[model samples]
Target chain A: MASVARKNLFEDIPRFLVAQAGIMFAVSLVTIQTGILNGFSRSTSALIDDSEVDIWVSAEEMVNLQLTLPIPAATVSEIHAMDGVEQAEAFISRTTTWRSPTGDIAPVQMIGFDPASRMFRMGQLTEGAIANLQEPYTVIPDRANLGALGLDEVGQSASINSLPVTITGFTRGTQSIASSAYVFASLRTANAYLNSGLTTTSNCQLEGDRLTCSNMFERDASDIALDPPRALRGSDGITFVMVKAQPGQDLNVLSRRIEAEFDGMVAHTQTELSTLTRNYWVGSTGIGFVLGLGAGVGVVVGVVIVSQILYASVVDHMKEFGTLKAMGASDWMIYRIIIEQALWMAILGYIPSIALCGGLGWWTFATQGITILITPGTAVVVLGITVGMCVVSALFAIQKVTHVDPAIVFKA
Target chain B: MVVSSLQSPVTYPIHSLPAPAASSSYPVEHQPRRAAIAADHLNMVFRSGGGSYPALSDVQLRVPSGIVQLLMGPSGSGKTTLLSILAGILTPTDGAVHLLGEDITQMSRRELARFRLENIGFIFQGFNLFPALTAAENVELALKTKGVSRRFARKEALDLLEQVGLADKAKQLPKNLSGGQKQRVAIARALASDPPLIMADEPTAALDSHSGHAVIDLLCRLAKERDRTVLMVTHDPRIIDVADRVLYLEDGKLTQTPQS
Candidate 1:
């Protein structure tokens, strides 16, 4: 009977509490581990996923979004001329050291975009002040990272590659999994960091209306050319050409067209680029496997703890259960009684598990600017796993209960 | 050896046991017209890695309805083993057991379980109640096991508890009740299913003489009134006057005539 299981579990309040505590610990381990994995995967592709661009065309010399050889800003011109190309912008990202006004340096990823296109959503971050980036040599840095970057306020100045850049506005807090602080600036400011815009003739100049390299990052400068030939015709350090297709245009088709026309460049639909970014972080690193192992350990710990509790309960009332068997209770009836107790443990532990996840999510985001994603779907999965583990453990314990001799009741 | 134990059609000497004073409506001779439980050439051997042990040897027994049969034997003589075989909790190593005219020993354990639920009630030496459950709830467990509806189970369990003179103890858990009250609850649970046969093993062992006599007297009265066959395994000799017949076993073999 349901009452039997209920009474058995509750007969000793201290024991029941201890059992539930173990279950809560186990479920929380699983929930938090998977939540972090989800957060890391999302952060890997956060920028790409958030962008409005339909296609991302990277230089043939590009390794990934974080490490890349800049293409000619002229690539944007070419895409703008293509059929069904609604808009195009030069999006550049590169790692550089930032020197705060206090002269402290930190590794930072500077993302440069054409202010006119505003495709990277500079306006939303600035409360419709995309024009702030229009200010010369101005940048937007996440507020969470400002203190670490040695700048404290919007008007403070910082140096990237020894070139002074002012912070005109602040973006919402964000953290890059690569351990780099994200900073948004205009293309001109990006050129300054590249040392390409140091002098009018230092890197590239406008040939008619197009910015082209007069001379690139060294035909022979060890720092400039990753591959010499690529450095020669280089777009002066523009990393990517972000394109938005016209309404009803097929993104796959447009990306294919771009790949066909460009030399040494990879054209990827938005979704493909997002997947590529996520895969690189999740598969190319050990983090995914490590998190999965943490979750698995949680399950094993849960099984052991629950099995011990149920088995201990069975032992405590060996005579009583034998009496039931002699009274003609079937094996199924005995098993159901234990399983019901397990179900109760699962149901009781689930709420606290998600509650712990929610609190951890908030703390992580607040301190590190990294989101720990815990969706309702994730909650449901945790509940299922918790219940499954408890039931399996109960069954393992009942094996011993059913095999026991019913005649033991008489002996007692 | 079997014939030496059961020398006649009657397994035990029925002439010795006094007529059950409680069963005045039916004399001892008037009973035994139909056997409520019958076992033929039963043997139970337990084999372990070390050796084999003969717990019951060439045992044959018959208990008629509406009477009490007391199984008396020394320790290790297999009195409990015989009771288990007849109740279908165990399959005898040889031969068959019939309860209420159905051959139970031939049935699978699953089938035997269902048959036991339908035809037999069991009481243990210890008042083996779930420590967490109240007295009435313990009785309700057997009623529910017999497929009684929840609506009727609670009411019937209370009625049985009252019949066992434990109306005031219905809501108390087993630990809170005295030994006598706990045994009364066990009896109530046994009668919850209203089976034709009631089997108890050392039902009075844990009680004092006063409570023990009172408990067994109440049990036999409740059972005889319902026309249920009462079979018990016990060593105490003071209960002879209350039993309709007595069977004795020695060295796993029933004696043709009890030494007492």
Candidate 2:
């Protein structure tokens, strides 16, 4: 009967198999592509690549790595001149609302950096160009943000903090998590609007294994003893310091040393801080759970579609099962027939699904500036899930077949 | 009905029947193991909805090896029910049915299936051939179920198909075969495993006279010449003359009639 089953399978190919193949193909595409996205998008940030870095300095106990920390300018200069140091620059980051010309307001990350810094040039722009840091009234936004801002070409004006800034050049990596627009501006301009024009020259500087502060930014500036405190105690300056270690330098060790030298400080590398930020977004903010919930919904949809197709096939061929049983074919033999049928369908479906998903993933990464990479292991997992779903659906038909008595073959 | 003669049956020795001095004959000894099927006071009950329904009761018969026994009755006369029991496809509610010396009523469901696979063959009224398989492939399925390898099973299936006069249509699907040809393929399938007993449920019902006679003749030849046992359930009088014995079933009771 096995031989007959094989021949029958070949003859039954076109009608039942085509439907099954279509469903499996869809499942393969969705699950595999989602898996690829989950695996490759490091830190799950909308705009970031996996790279090595050493230390990140933030305010003590600040959970938001990107948006926290208000270090004085004196500490920035002192960190650059510290032992085994390379360079130090002031950094400012905050989340602000962008009010479009159409009066539409959306949440955005306003990143403040030095015009002459390398961190500003770290990401590649997908559209327009990066902002000129030396320019006081210009900003660069992510391409997605460019669309939201209705700013297509250069010289388009958008309001950040109600301050009009020209869209000098569109840049990539502007999203924080899920297409939240990111804007880059000068630290000087950012601080001006932050405190009602009480702008002060920051006294933070780096020198000889220590980042010391003038303590002018503190409420009790007199009582606190600061190493290398400015001779002129009354000085105001930028509120944060961002230090970049030289290539091949250990910033984790340097960060530890800086914290020991200057108490009540936080320091981390770019990689550590990015991971920390992503964890904050996905874990505390509940966005990661939302994306995961979407993937689970995709799996449920795949199962329902695949099962319906298999059930219809089973209903069509019920008499054949009765005949086989009357001819002395056992229940296991019939089960093999159904499972083999489903197995073939799954294999056929997986081929086109993988291809379609690969194309979609490529297109998504290319157009969105999001990295989604599909690995061989992830492909295997998707194949297993597809076939597993097929088998689960086939089990219903098999149960029906087993319950069929040979007597039915002759009765009708 | 000569029931008394059967009850007081006498045993015979070799050479009891007159034979020419020039003719030779094989022994016709009843080996007791020669009882291919025996049912003593069998009963079958089906329960459904609110109550139990009796499908068969007090059925008793014995069919010896190397003879064709025909079971005849009207529709719902328990002919199929009896056939189901004798073929080990269903268990009797009471009494015992022994096929080749093993009481099938006591066998487990799995055991009964294995016994049926190894010892019994069935030909359904519709021929019940898998529509997608060719004639030879259908026969091959029977042999394959008996654990024959694909290579040897195909060769044997081809030989069986040729014996049933279907070698020319070996590769044709059931949809393309005539009613008679399809039944011939079914017969070939029933004979594939060389089982000791063959049961046919109206095997010749759908065939024309010529085809019907050919089918009965093939079954008779296999019985008398090959020592195979055959039991056919049918209401066709045309086949009654070919049987070594006949049993009539009415309301699930068996009545034996001996030929003069």
Candidate 3:
């Protein structure tokens, strides 16, 4: 029975596909948008997700990684002294201008980490090596921003906030949703450039028990003729502190302890920070709502298309169904025939739609450098929605079939 | 000899009727057949915006087992309506129908469908073979509905097609077959269930005289050989001579016509 019904459904291939085209378009729209949304949500917190740390200490009112305020450098020392804390490092993320070789200044989000602690790992390098960042005034820029940053090669020279710097390497997969190019630099280089009037020598030396440094220089007669020299300040403030717990230590316990011990800082596990960052972009911002609305519209459009097509097929086959009824077929039997046709349509329509969505995802990634993740789990979920759409359409067809008068077969 | 006249229609409740006696009009070997179809005071009326109209009125019928019965009537004479009522496809406005000894009028739609599947086989005028299915599949579908296994039903469907002299064309779709071949396939489907009663509405109307005569001859032989009751509606006088009994209906009134 199923085979016969399927043959009947596909008797006119052109007509059948035309009927299913609307459904396919709608499904593809939903699938592609969902893939993009998944990629966007993951990329929003890619940094926090990829950080090799167990706990993160941030300013008290910090909401997300992008909008974090500065926290005093003293938090790192306090967290390192607590129990279950094997190591802690101050991580600085600041947005500054990059002067390209062609004299184009582009805003870049610079990530500064202690290379010796290895608290953060640079993304896959397309050129050069991450170890070269140990040299002062060296940085690794993401390959995605190579055009925007206007650097030709690894040995190209550039300046960060008017400070001389060399592009030592290129990284991949470090693109952010904020559309700002990301660059990796050592802790010392970033502090010197980000905090103006801070001499490299005074930035290194620390005062007793506190991170305070000052510059003392005798005024020369020639310097007095020009602008007076300003006092040097130390780079002692950080946006966050990345902490690694000792072996067998629970991050949740350590986070709670750090929060209790500190007054002006808050501690969160890696997973918590990742979720907070994603939620800030997906919920507080309207991107998630807009994508969700698109998906909902896709579903509605799919339902309407499938229902109309199934209903039309039922109408076309009314006489045949009437004959079946006269041949002693029950209402249930007729329902089965119609439902089987619907299932076939759904399964067949989904094949091309999924393929189309996958191709679109690949093309978008290749051309625009935007990640669109079409995972296996996404396919299964979309398949369920497709089948559900067909089943709902079948229900409408069944209503028309159940009321068919078998006696109509007797008419001339 | 004719048992009843055309003007005075015979009416009897199935439960009260006695077992039929041997009739000289029928063969000696086929005597004393049981009643396969019985109706009492069957009436069907169509009420429309114009006014109430009667399709069948005060009709009572009994078709004996193992004989071919032909119902002939002019247009708008309610031959098809009466057949529909007898086949349990439609409920009479007033009257009771007992098919194969069951009161089909009292049965629900689902029960009637089951009863029809088990006892009655129908052949339609248009040949009504599912266009997508091959000749053999058309017959196998009925058997499957009767709970036969697919493999066994396939074998049996082919055998029935062979019985109807279309074994070579078993795999051909309906559109590829001639009108006579399509009708033969329909006959095979009707016999797939081994039904005790076979009902056909204008089964040969769409075929030529040659094909029409061949199909009627096949139905007559199946009825006589298998002891199954065959009832059909037709306007063709050429096939009337093949029936054991011929009933005439005019304006929903039925009368028995003696065979010459």
Task: Tell me, by DockQ, which candidate is best.
Answer: 1
lDDT at residue A24 of model 2 (Cα atoms) = 56
Query: What is candidate 3's CAPRI-style docking category based on DockQ?
Result: medium
List the candidates' TM-scores in order: 0.86, 0.76, 0.87
- Tens digits of per-residue lDDT for model 3, A89-179: 8888888999999899999888888766666776678898877877877899987788899977898998877667889988887676654
Per-residue CA lDDT of model 1 for B1-260, tens digit only, reads 01121112333323433343341212233332467777767788999998999988776666776677788887788898888888888788987788877889778888888888888888888888998999989999889888899889999998999999989888898989989899999999989878889999998889898889988889888886887888999988766667776778777777645654
Higher-DockQ candidate of 1 and 3: 1
Runs off by more than 4 Å, candidate 1: A60-63, A115-118, A122-130, A196-235, B1-32, B47-52, B255-260
CA lDDT of each candidate?
A: 0.79, 0.67, 0.81
**Candidate 2 vs. true structure, TM-score:** 0.76
Q: How accurate is candidate 1 locally (lDDT)?
A: 0.79
**What is residue B223's positional error in candidate 2, in angstroms?**
6.2
DockQ of 2: 0.34
| Chain A only: TM-score per candidate | 0.86, 0.70, 0.86
Best by TM-score: 3
What share of the reference contacts survives in each candidate?
Answer: 0.68, 0.39, 0.54
* Steric overlap count per candidate: 2, 34, 0
Chain A superposition TM-score, candidate 2: 0.70
